[model samples]
Target: MTTEEIRAEARGQAEAHLRALVGSDSAVLRDDQWSAIEALAVDSRRALVVQRTGWGKSAVYFVATLLLRSRGAGPTVIVSPLLALMRNQIAAAERAGIRAVTINSTNIEQWQPINDAINAGEVDVLLVSPERLNNPGFRDEVMPRLAATCGLLVVDEAHCISDWGHDFRPDYRRIRTLLADLPPGIPVLATTATANARVTADVAEQLVSATGEQEVLVLRGSLDRESLRLGVVRLRTAEMRLAWLADHLAEQPGSGIVYCLTVAATQEVAAFLRDRGHEVAAYSGQTDPTERAALESALVEGRVKALVATSALGMGFDASLGFVINLGAPQSPVAYYQQVGRAGRGTDDATVVLLPQLEDRDIWAYFASLAFPPEQLVRQTLEVLAQAPGSMSTVALETYVELSRNRLETLLKVLDVDGAVRRVKGGWVATGEPWSYDADRYARVAQARQREQDAMLDYLDTDRCRMRFLRDQLDDPDATDCGRCDNCGGLTLSSSVTEAAVDEAGAALSRPGVAIEPRKMWPTALANLGLDLKGKIGDGPVEGRAIARLTDLGHGQALRALFRADAVDGPVPPPLASALLTVMKDWAGDWTDRPVAIVGVESASRPQLVGDLATGLSRVMQIPVVGRFAIVDASVAPGQGAANSAQRVAAIHRRFRLEADVPAGPVLLVDDLVVSGWTLTVAGVALREAGATAVLPLTLGTQT
Candidate 1:
């Protein structure tokens, strides 16, 4: 056959495959789509695709996998980041006649079978989560073989690999190690819809093989989502935002998402919306894997009005959601854009709105605090690891170090990258390699975060086109005024809330009391810290109640104001006092008996507030203000040396003493805030030892 005829025949087959895959008769491939597939399947070259969401990025990879397999290539290895994304990819691959299987935390039982299938060449594509890249079994047994023999390697949500990316994860950094182990000349593909120019370039660079003999083809596309009608509805208070959403959600085009900054807010907003007669659900990292899948399916099938969520539902959601409303702005515009991108994908029009809150910066700071551990702490961890002769389980190390569980795990991953430690069968072992904490790199990252924060703020305040501002933040060369947005098109959301609606929202917000789940067990490995504590906290305090969470949308603002460092320590505000009474009345009726007296935890900073809360509650409930738990030493202040459970228990171990005779019956213990719950635990212990029959703890708020 002639060369031109052969080329035409190949293109014909590719087009026919696309038609069958999309179930469309006129499924002509875009130039960029064809280019990406040609690079991966024909030229056998690495490629990085930076396109908008719903732009057929998955089609490129699926088609490439099919074509590569047709030529007798082995199964493709896709390092996906989320279970939802993996599920969607597997379904799409199956539709294209590319059999796909996944190995993720949600499906361990299928691993052996999937591995067997891969060995037998029965699976054309295998999807694994980014975190699985470090799983002991997968990393040591499966990854090396896949690296050597997999037909193609694809990194979905590739921006996650770059620290500069808004949603950067330490787990994704393991990809570089995976890339290094890949045999040369294996065509690789990295794809993401959120990367700006810097992140795109950074990720593209990582696609290079260990030997650096091959080049990566960069394909960039405009990020403007024509279907998204972007806008910001600035409300004076969080209650107003909730009221507005409750009033307007029914007016949105289709079932959508209500994004929140914290898990607490997700549930709170979902509840508020439900009370307003809307069908909604809450989704977050806390959601169970099976439940998360169900929730995703519900949203996809339009069974719920919306899913109030955190970033856990931010990415990997494949539904063509019709609207996305942000209850509070994300810290970065890139992050915001990626989230809003979830809407209007398959539809012709979708609404995207951001309701920026004053508390967003505080939430941002709280999360950022966990970003990179301090050099001193990192070194302390390394020193401990080096001294240990054998692998140290994370639980074992937590007792020695003071970081929280998640933070500690993140630090360990970073250390592994720096060669200070290695993950083995039992746990992690020290490599004893000389490693310097990358102070400059961390500082740069911190600065980048601050810059992103500033950019987000600018996005909110800019009178220019909203979409244009976002596009510019992403370094999109074709960024122009998206006429669909509020700024450019003179569109504005109705911030109007009826008086009745406002009153209802205010009542909902003012209604206080969150169940403070008592600590049932002591942190693992606390004995290793020489504290002599182990297992369940046998006589630990029972379930307690707090007036509200500091992150709550309604009472949260008032509580935050009262807790502010600059606020004068005084009596509990009348509104909070009223809320406390309601909380007490609404307290679980299962309490065997009413409290006999009020005992306040002494606070150096909020002495007046804590004292007044105890006195005020005593007067209202007619219970005696028996006595205060005197600070034995007052040397270790609350929250000092309380980063982790062991340290927290140690700090407050003997810190409190019952000042006088305890009440014979249940005693109502009070505090300004329940941060670690250790204070309450130790104080309850002291009371129980002193003679109280039972303790029912009450607090103004619970820290996030």
Candidate 2:
């Protein structure tokens, strides 16, 4: 048969497979989708597909898998980003008679069986997270075999492979080594719905063959989602945003997602919405795997109005979501596009609204602080690891390093990818590979991030066109005024919320008292730091109460303002004083033993606030004002308590001594702020040793 005749036959088979996948005889692949499939299956060429969501990107891979397997090719390997995405892909593969299996953190028990199935050639596709690629067992044991026999390699959410991408993940960089190891002529496909020209070029460069013999076919298309009607709602306060959502959320077309900038906001918003008669659930990275899966299922089945989520629910969650509302603007326009893309996938018309808050920049700044640590810290971490006798677990390393657990884990991943360290069975070991910190490159990346932030600010205030502005930010050549957004003839949502709604939301938020669970177990390796502490803390403070989390939607703002670096240290304000009294009143009702005395934790900063809070509480509850703890060493820095658990514990251990008399009864231990909770714990221990029966801690706010 002629080449055209063979291509026609392959196209026919592809369409039949697509029909089966979508469960519709009328289903057909778009022209570009077929081109991607043809490039992968027919030409055995590398391809990058940059199309909008719900554009059948998965169909291209599934159909290509069937076509390639027909010619005796091995199974396809997909590096997916999210568990929810992997679950959806496996389900879709089943529709087309393609056997798919996944190995992720959630399914440890099934990994061996899945690996056996792959070896036996019983699985047509194997899905794994990028992090799994770095797993010593998988990379050393299974990856080699799979690489040798892999028919096709797919990188879903390909933008993650580029540091220039908005959601750059260090684990995604491991793909370069895998690509280098793949056999020649193996078709590779990278697909994402959110990538600008810069990110696209970076990913395409990574897609090239190690020998530089293969060129990647780049297929870019318009990023305009016709079904979306975008708008921006400007609200002055967090309560106003909540009230607006409370009043208008049910008016949205269908069940959708409500995205929050932080986990605290997700819980606060979801709870408020539920109270306002909207069925919603909160989701964040902290959620358990089982609960996350159930929440996803609930949203998919239309059992809930929306799932208030963080970026944890961002990539590859498949649902016919009809609306998306952002309580606060994302840090960048690219992230905003990726999130709003989740809506309007199956419906012809969907609502996409952004409620931009002035506080959004504060959230952005907090995330910025978590970026790659400074050079000195990085070098110190490496030196510590190099001097270790053997492999050290993260907890063990934390005793020597000052970084938090999350930040330390992130740095280790980057070091592992850079060959400066290697993850072994028990823990991580120094690789002894020569590595240099690229300060210039990191500076440029930081500057680029700033530019993205500026662009997002422009997006919030732009009067031209919302959809077109987003498309232009993504470098979509086909961007044009959609004439469907609020700026272009669509109905604009009102920022005006009912007074009753605002009052209700404010009341809910103002009603403070977040439970501060006591740390039962001491941090690992505390003894190594020269503190005799180990195992469970014997006399820690009982479960305490704080006015709110520093990340909370309501009281957090006020507390943040008061705790600013330049803010003058003064007595507690009237409003906070009233809130404290209310907290004590509410707390006393549930107390088995009322506090007979109040004691203040010595504060290097905000001493007035701490002392005033304790004295006021004592006066209101008619309890005696006990003496406060005094700092033993005045030379200790103010933020010594902000380090890792072991470090914080060591810094504060024996640093304070009870200066006042203590009655033999429960006492309210007061502080201005609680971070790491080491100060309270140490102070509580001292007070207990001073004859107090029990310690009930209280604080203005808790920093998470």
Candidate 1 residue runs with Cα over 4 Å from true position: 1-9, 490-492
TM-score of 1: 0.97
lDDT of 1 at 99: 87
For every candidate in turn, the CA RMSD to the true structure comes to 1.7, 1.5
Tens-digit lDDT string for candidate 2 (82-185): 99999999999998899999999989999989988998989999999999999999988889988999999999999999888999999998899899999998
The lDDT per prediction is 0.87, 0.90
**lDDT, candidate 1, 143-218, per-residue tens:** 9999888999999999999998998888898888988887777899999999988898899898887777777899
TM-score of each: 0.97, 0.98
Residue 539 shift from truth in candidate 1, angstroms: 1.7
